[model samples]
Target: MRSGNPRDTDLWEWCCGFYPGSHPGECSGGTAATFDQARADFEAAWRLFLANRTEADFQAWRDHKAWTAEKYRRFDRGERMPHDWRPGQ
Candidate 1:
């Protein structure tokens, strides 16, 4: 996402902070030079979130959200991440 600062446009800025299931504007974090770097921060935060979760916990999270198991599977298989999932979906 582009930041208000024009210099941040080319940087791989973190879209959200360490909160799992967080979307843009829900949290905050720093930036990086590349996507891999940005994703590393996200993954680290996600791992921390998952550390306290059970299978049921994860299921519960998905139950009311746009993300689904099938979509996650596709993501795990290296498919392009789904973007159609939104509040109404």
Candidate 2:
């Protein structure tokens, strides 16, 4: 997200991680004066994140994300789910 208005932020911001599955401080993102800089920052953060985690952990996150996506697809198709079913649940 790029913003020029002073009320918001005079920089470009970007998030390179998923949510609802991400715990606090698990998301990778950053803001910079330019769009390219912001994207570079996000990429750097993502690389660091990968370096800090095991392959198994990354795979687990991928599986969870896929599951969440499938739920969303089912909902979109008008399939009925239990009342307790919710996105990311």
Candidate 2 lDDT for residue 19: 42
TM-score per candidate, chains pooled: 0.42, 0.58
Model 1 CA lDDT for position 89: 48
lDDT tens per residue, model 1, 5-71: 6773557766433223343454546677778878898777656655655676545456544455656
In model 1, the runs with Cα more than 4 Å from the true position are: 1-4, 8-10, 15-29, 66-89
Which one is best on lDDT? 2
Q: Could you tell me which residue pairs clash in candidate 1?
A: none
Error of 1 at 6 (Å): 2.1
Clashing pairs in 2: none
